[model samples]
Target chain A: MRAGERAYQALRADIVEWRLLPGQVLGEVELSERLGISRTPVREALSRLTADGLTEPHSGRGVVVATISAEDVRSLYEFRDSLDCRAAELAARRGDPEVFRALAGELLEALEGLTSDDDPDHASYYELVQRMDAAIDEAAANPFLRQAQTGVRLHLARVRKLSKSDPRRLASAAVEHQRIAQAIADGDPALAIATTRVHLSNALQHALNTKELAPVRPAAS
Target chain B: MRAGERAYQALRADIVEWRLLPGQVLGEVELSERLGISRTPVREALSRLTADGLTEPHSGRGVVVATISAEDVRSLYEFRDSLDCRAAELAARRGDPEVFRALAGELLEALEGLTSDDDPDHASYYELVQRMDAAIDEAAANPFLRQAQTGVRLHLARVRKLSKSDPRRLASAAVEHQRIAQAIADGDPALAIATTRVHLSNALQHALNTKELAPVRPAAS
Candidate 1:
């Protein structure tokens, strides 16, 4: 891989995984030295990260990871409500039925393992949701929409860390995914849109409630 | 303005205005010389344009302007239907009533001048549409949604050149904008979404027809 791309992927993974917390300063020289690369590639990667809204310029501290407030979460889901619903509708209209059918079956199977107390199952369920998202984007066959959806999902990934421990939310989300998959498999655009709306609304509520009870940042090291 | 920003604005204007035709190779040295800037800034500008989907990397040709097919127009409108509707709905809920009321009045006045033979009026009508778009985005007040909408509008600008000569289309579009503005002014989300849907459907039809009739490119200069 190209050095810039490698740096981008590494930095992006760190940010998304919350290994690099929000508001953490990312000095280009420090990152270049730590990653064993030249400053050029690190600078390029930081520019891309800023473009992706993952980081922002600080007056004197270089770039810092962007923080997600409750308001940001609310706005993110509101935007997702439009994007996910449209994606599901388009996927139903243009997607391969067999692909969605297989996905529906997989989602159903995944739901069976999603108990309220199983942490591993919740992790796997999130993975299944990501797969479903990819399948829907593929089925939709619109590059522009996919690009927009991808941008929103990047932030959604970061926000997911704020609510990942809720088992009940995981279980309900699994059922919601099943409904969306089945609707797409059946080639029902309206049903797919409706189900997606429900899923996004439920997910937003859970994110908001979880955010209310949890601290947004880790204890200072 | 910064050199990169200058290059970006100049190149973007060329693309949107069709001076830089789709599929035309964008040689870095040539553009830098023409724009009177260094290759570094021109390169950065091209990179930004690529991110905007206005250009793409070719196998042997470096980067060339991206082409829009009939299918691309279809897909663009399908995505716009979702975006414009959501933006209008949000604007209705959150926007300033007086702003839209004034915009609606302006649209109504523009409609009066949009006769089939008056080309200048048509240009002004399109500008009004752009202002209304900006106002609605401002009212929606979500930076993420605005960003997504702005990306889509970048391509939409290129597509507009494909169908700008149709006076009847312009007149009807003016009326449609008036309705959307009025709905937002009245704080009716449902009405705003409904009018936006109508406008997008009409726009898609017009673009598809225009693509069918117009040659995708001009003969060699």
Candidate 2:
């Protein structure tokens, strides 16, 4: 892989995983040396990161990792209320019902082992949710909306990784997911939007409950 | 100031204004010569334009200015319906009434002479709409939404520049704008969203009316 691409992936993962916390300074020279890369590649990585909102220009030199406060998350949910609802509505209006019907069935099946402490089923559960998101986007069939959602989801990923999910929320969220998928499967645009709004409201509450949350399940899992 | 930045702006303007037509190849070497810059800067400019959705990778080599068919405009407006409604609603709920109330008055005042063939009042009318947009963004206070909307608006700008405007449509649109401004000024979120939807529906019709549009007014104007 090219040095710049490799540097970007590594740094992005680090920032998302919170190995590099908010407000941490990233010096180009130091990162280049530590990552066994040259300054040019490191510079490229930093620029990409800055564009992604993971870092911002510092007063002295280099950049500091950007902060995402609780308030930011609140605003994000408010924004998501706008975006996610429309996506759901469009999916119901245009999507293949059988696809969502199958997803709803899988969501119900996944509910059984969700409360286990080891969380063995969490990965597949999260994967299932991602599949639902993909299906909705495909059904919506609006490239402009897809592009906009991509930007929002990146920051949501960071917030999700930081959030600590309890089994209770996960179980509740599964039922919400089932309802949302079913509504889409029924081709009920209004119901699809309504269910989506309920899910997001609950998700926001769970996200805010964590004060330095212990990472476990991903958002909406 | 930089060669790459300058080339990007020049190319972007050309593409948006339709001087660089869709399907026209943008060769790095050719653009470099035309813009009086080196290959590296031309490459950088192309990459930025691709990122901006103004251009796309060609089959053989280089890139072509991306196409926005009438169909693309339809999809774009569908996407805008989701985004703009939320923004207007947020503004009505959270924004100070005085700002939007003042804008409503200006919109009403500007209704006269809107049908003039010279279109002398266009620039200021459009500027006022822009100010209303800015006020909504501030009142909404969601950076994520702002970022997403910015991406959508770039493509919308291209579509807007391409479409020909008739005096009848422009006059009707002015009254619609006045109503939208009044709704927001009233601090009624539902009414704000409803008014926004009506305006977008009309705007979409105006945008798609031109088979081979003669440039006259901006999108909303």
Which has the greatest lDDT? Answer: 1
lDDT of 2 by residue, B66-126 (tens): 8777778888899888889999998898899999889888887777757654566487678
Each candidate's clash count:
0, 0
| Candidate 2 residue lDDT tens string, A1-221 | 87988998999989888788777889999999999989877877887787677888997588988788888888888888888999999999999999999999999888886865466549888999999999999999888878767767877888888767677888999999999999999999999999999999999988888645433322220
Candidate 1 scores an iRMS of: 0.9
Shift in Å, residue A220, candidate 1: 8.9
The CAPRI class of candidate 1 is: medium
Which 10 residues in a row give candidate 1 chain A its minimum summed lDDT?
A212-221
> Candidate 2 chain A vs. true chain A: TM-score?
0.90
| Best candidate (score: DockQ) | 1
Clashing pairs in 1: none
> Which lDDT values do the candidates have, in the order given?
0.84, 0.84
For model 1, the stretches where C-alpha displacement exceeds 4 angstroms are: A59-62, A116-123, A212-221, B116-123, B212-214, B217-221
lDDT of 2 at B215: 36
Best by TM-score: 1
TM-score of chain B of each: 0.90, 0.90
Could you tell me how far off, in angstroms, the CA of residue A195 lies in candidate 1 after the best superposition? Answer: 1.4
